[model samples]
Target: MNDETIPQITDSHCHLDFPDFEGKLPDFVARAAEAGVTRMVTICTKLRNEPNVRAIAEAHAPIFYAAGTHPMSVAEEPMVTVDQLVALSAHPKFVGIGETGLDYHYTSDSAQVQKQSLRRHIEAAQRTGLPLIIHARAADDDMARILAEEHRNVPYACVMHCFSSSADLARAALDLDFYLSMSGIAAFPKSQELRDIFAAAPVERILVETDAPYLAPPPHRGKRNEPAFTAHTARVGADLFGLDYVDFAAQTQQNFDRLFAKAAQYKAAA
Candidate 1:
């Protein structure tokens, strides 16, 4: 599609500070803008990295950020607290609370620690009224149970970031008004099972992401993924939904706006 017809896109999730693009970030950012990505959310996976993440967001009018620790590292030194997360998120540019949740794919030995950390992150999300960015892999049942258990006391919006779990889990999140974000993995040929879930999800609940410096879609598969590559995932989603690229892009942008309501501030300026 031409620049005029390419719908303005928002990468609801990405790590702009990831080492892959550190020295060449400006060029990548320029290319992403040229590719029609109007806004992006730079996710912070560690409280210590929140400053760098926030700085990136602060430096770019179109970039927003989140504050929370990755579940895999929760048991490590310098654990994050609800107060710290709340404080870090006070910045006008900070709009969400995570990159949090269980990741059994990497370390299944500490399931309890992961669960506890996820609870803390969820609590922070509730305390701050910001959406949670969940990263669940190979632990859908446990993630669902924990989310359901905490839903009563710490109700808050959520996005199953980089969703690669079962359709049942997606249904549970949607039933709770949580959004589901699709990353480049959704565009992989081996991910047809995942695409089936996306195909069945409500368009209003679907958001697009690149999860950059990681999960680059086909053709770009082996290279670093970036916000500019989000368009491909959007294209794949649009194709699965039987809609044209423009319409699909518009729908995902709308989904991003509604899910991360604070994003509207950046969108308006864009």
Candidate 2:
């Protein structure tokens, strides 16, 4: 299909600054546009890499960014402060607070520090009025508890980026009016369980992503991923939701604009 016929969508999460896309962002962005992925949020997983990630966003009009010390890196990197994250939000293209949350899959040993960092990012989200981008793994209990607990203290928006978690965790996030981002992982053949979880969610709360440099969905599975492949994952979401591709795409666009209001405003003003 041509661009006008292809359903336009946003890759609500990705990592354009990773070495996989080094010196090749323009081509990737072009390919994404061709695939009808009109916008992308490139995530910064470490505080030190914020400048590089920010530069990627600054260099590409279709890109925006979010930064935080990822749970896996919490022990190795200095802990992030709410003030530092709030300050970064000053940039027009800095759109979200984190790719933060608990990840017991590999870094379970640093649970305490990860929790501390997650809370700080949550506070930053609270302070900046930006959605907190979360990366939850095998730590559903703690992740849900902390997020719900903190939301009670002061409400903040969030999206469970690249979400492939338990139905319980999904419900917890949805209960707090948060979003669940569907990545290429949900398009995997064996991801029926994950798809079922998403199928049970409110369509208004669903978003889509590529999580580029990883989880490239079928046809490109086991290969390096990119924003262009977001369409593959989104097709899966459309099927799961029993909606036509265009309708699902439009739903996600509305969901994205609602959660990432800054990026939506930027596009409107442009």
My TM-score estimates for the predictions, one after another, are 0.95, 0.99
Judged by whole-model lDDT over C-alpha atoms, candidate 2 comes out at 0.94
Model 1, which residues run further than 4 Å from truth?
none
Task: Look at candidate 2 and tell me the lDDT of residue 247.
Answer: 100
Cα lDDT computed for each candidate against the true fold: 0.86, 0.94
Clash pairs, model 2 backbone: none
lDDT of 1 by residue, 135-201 (tens): 9989989999889888877688999999989999999998888888999999999999999999999
Error of 1 at 31 (Å): 0.7
lDDT of 2 by residue, 85-198 (tens): 999999999999989999999989999999999999999999999999999999999999999999999999999999999999999999999999999889998999999999
Highest lDDT model number: 2
- The positional error of residue 205 in candidate 2, measured at the CA in angstroms, is 0.6
Give the Cα-based TM-score of candidate 1 against the true structure: 0.95
